[model samples]
Target: MQLRHFQNEFPYLVKALLSAKKAGRLSHSFLIHNDDGKLADDFSISLAQALACTNPLPDGDSCGNCVVCKQLEHRTYSELFTLAPVSKSRQIVIGVDDTIPDTMRWFRSLFHMKSSMAGGIKIGIIYDADCMNDESQNCFLKTLEEPPPSSHVLLVTANPFTLLPTIRSRCQSILLLRNKTSYEDEKIRGIAGIMWELMSSSNKISTAEECAFAMISISDNLEKFAEEKADVKWDRIFEDSKYLEPPAKKRLEKQHEAAISAEYLKMRDSMLSLIHSWSAQAYMLSCGIPRDSIANPELFPRDLNVISSIDPEKAYRMMRKSEDLLQILNWNVDTDLAFREFCMGVEFGK
Candidate 1:
């Protein structure tokens, strides 16, 4: 991730961060929240590179060809540490080890030592930052309060609301956008078709079970796609390390599996959000809003026929219900049960 990549999508954020760096007034910590996980990851990487680069541009952006930048690309930079969840399950909510505090303490200790490179900056990036449990978060607060000089912390998460208030208040928050082209247009159309059909069905109440099943099928297909992508990514890595020691190979395999599972959950959540967006549009349509005025019509053609039949009051109620279900999912409620409840609550054609 480099400044050029986000210059168009997030011009303000890019300019702000770089300007701060150039002015020698960069914040010690930042909390980045957005629906785009990939972009958030890239942004953090770019920040790290800018801070550690030996040759920076006048705007404080990293020179992509520098030795520090190359080392970062190879993941061999000694001063850049990344923290993330270590879940092996396909559950939406993941668990992190209780030793995060210890990790942070050790990181601080390292920062106190002489800089490893000439840049004299140590970076700590926490991906899926919201996954930290209460105990771990409490522990992390200590380090946040008295962070080392010349140290920068980046906390990246899609759901920043789940993070503790104190933690959020201590950091500058930035929001990012999900690139429109990143979504699969065909899959979105399919999901929208299902929603339209469910709304137009003769027996709205009875169709709950049917709609629930359809949604599950879509979710399953998405998970499979995520798994295939992860496999393709890891195949080359494994092939290159065929002569690795037995224990090392086993560890790598485990890590690979966990990564696949995490990717699946991330994809699943994004799919669900797509569905929710459709419902939101349906609600707007129910309220006599013009179709052309609706957001994201490209993702799904507005189903005027079905939308006309839905009760505005009922659609509003269901919209709120869907949001509640999303919160429930974030709280680690059983995915199947929560989704079922949401499907059952959705009402069409009053």
Candidate 2:
């Protein structure tokens, strides 16, 4: 429950804060850029605890004996605010719509309240800053322009370039050093985390089926999104893949050590492509265009028109199943050929 989550989990802000604390320098606004997986997410939350804790060590550790410390361990702390991109569960791309005036109002209203206990700092953390659209970023910019005296904003993202240039310039940014931090490496470890959990289920076949379906849904949307918005860059996903250094790269290469095969990696690649496809499909469907109108094999088109032509709810269910399967696949699975069975399970009528 403490900041020392794991030996490898180096909650990042330790070094950053140490440098700033020693230099007697701290920023009112911060944008933390790094690779995905829960590493950055976990680190961001821990940093919030460390910052808000009234009882903290000079070495930047929280006093585990305090009420605030107990609150953080159980995720019931009032002073902490967390926002992240919409998952497949929401079926909404995290865009301007998600960050409306009402949304900001909701968060601001919460922050306006006094701390539940004495001497705790209020903290705001966004899990994916890059997911915010231009307008939404503009909306947030106003919030950052006038942060509270006892408040700090920490934004986590794999791709900061997608953020508004103005927004990037305003915040103090923390870049995860390659060798220095595993907080940014979300490769094999991430996939492993997902797969191990899935393999533990009572029905491995159904679990695998769900993963296959979810990947297709994700791929369809990503592909469609790419096609519709050429200006859009999935630079983050690829950057996430590329950010792997010698150690991470070695881990990926040593998939066999983890009981993952080459086929598993291929399926993972296919899963990425499928998400790209789903992006394109999502854009088209949202825009009221026929899925078949833009049928380019190189492009990702869910043919949502065709799929929904039969049963819209059924098709949507498939997407949900796909998401479920992906979650299960996150655990220990043979990356090489495991997805073939998964993809086949999710294949539906044309």
Candidate 3:
């Protein structure tokens, strides 16, 4: 998508970057982060296009029809080098040999050559940058420390804490505003409904039981969804590797298992984020914030009338509790137990 497409969603960010570009003060390295990976990825591309566009719009966005913009959109631009996790382990490795593709060595070598287009900037983007192992990160860190002239590096990841503090400190960070939580899935909607009921109910004892059931249901559904997605992915790979030996096949099976676990954890984190947003909105409503100013205002709309009756201090405490729950889950605790504890511990009304 062109830069214009994101203007409505990220007007301040787009305008700031464009203004910096106009002043020839664009940072050489950036760390673009968001809970939604696709949004982060697209925004990075749009930012790069704006920097490289030969013909810019009046608002300082890239002229989408320009050859440079089109090439960047399709990722065919010679000046743009993109790297992502390619291994079954889903890692960006530091290759020992220079001939290997997408390794730190190869990525750095791209900048060593003359720019494919005269006076054009070289852009290197690392998608899922958190996948870079320690060695790979260290190798890339050198590039960040001493980047080539007229070159820009973009690191995109949903999880930024996985990156080293040194690496994070070296780049200009952009944290995108999260899009509204989507409850399009029936199961998710059910969970949201149960959560709202648990929060709003005057009878805490029975509501706790329902909250426990919702936690269990969410856990089960997350596992099933992850497994189904992994199965589809593994089947395609298995079909293409008909001649693989038994040992390799076994390794592939292990990779498939890892993929399933990864998928589950990713989805679980997303759910936790959603829960956090829910509590945050509750706190805001309790503080008398306008509905339009809050994120996910559409959630529990009918029940919002009762928010004024609830104690703002209690709502604020619940929001902090939600934050603590997220940190606790990150420690690899039992998901069901942690969720149950959180749900049961919630205090409602005054």
Can you rank all candidates by TM-score, best first? 3, 1, 2
- TM-score, candidate 3, is 0.55
C-alpha lDDT score of every prediction, in listed order: 0.71, 0.53, 0.78
Number of colliding residue pairs in each model = 0, 41, 0
What's the lDDT for residue 127 in model 2?
68
Give one digit per residue, the lDDT tens place, for model 3 in 63-128. 888888899999899899888999899999999976799787888887657776778878999999
- Tell me the deviation in Å of residue 132 in model 2: 1.0
lDDT tens digits, residues 1-350, model 1? 56767887666568778998899888888988767787777778888888878889997899988877877777778877767765553112322443343244444455456676665678888788887776557767776898866788898887765677678778876656554423463553576777765655654666877777777777658767777879888999999889999999999989998988897877776676776667776776787766765556654455667457876776666655665666666776677777677777665422
lDDT (tens digit, per residue) of candidate 2 on 170-275: 8876644232221112331233323323322334566656655443444335434333333233334335668677787676545423333333454455544343
Give the lDDT of residue 297 in candidate 3: 67
Estimated TM-score per prediction?
A: 0.48, 0.45, 0.55
Flag the better candidate by TM-score, 1 or 3: 3
Candidate 1: where is the Cα deviation over 4 Å? 89-119, 179-350
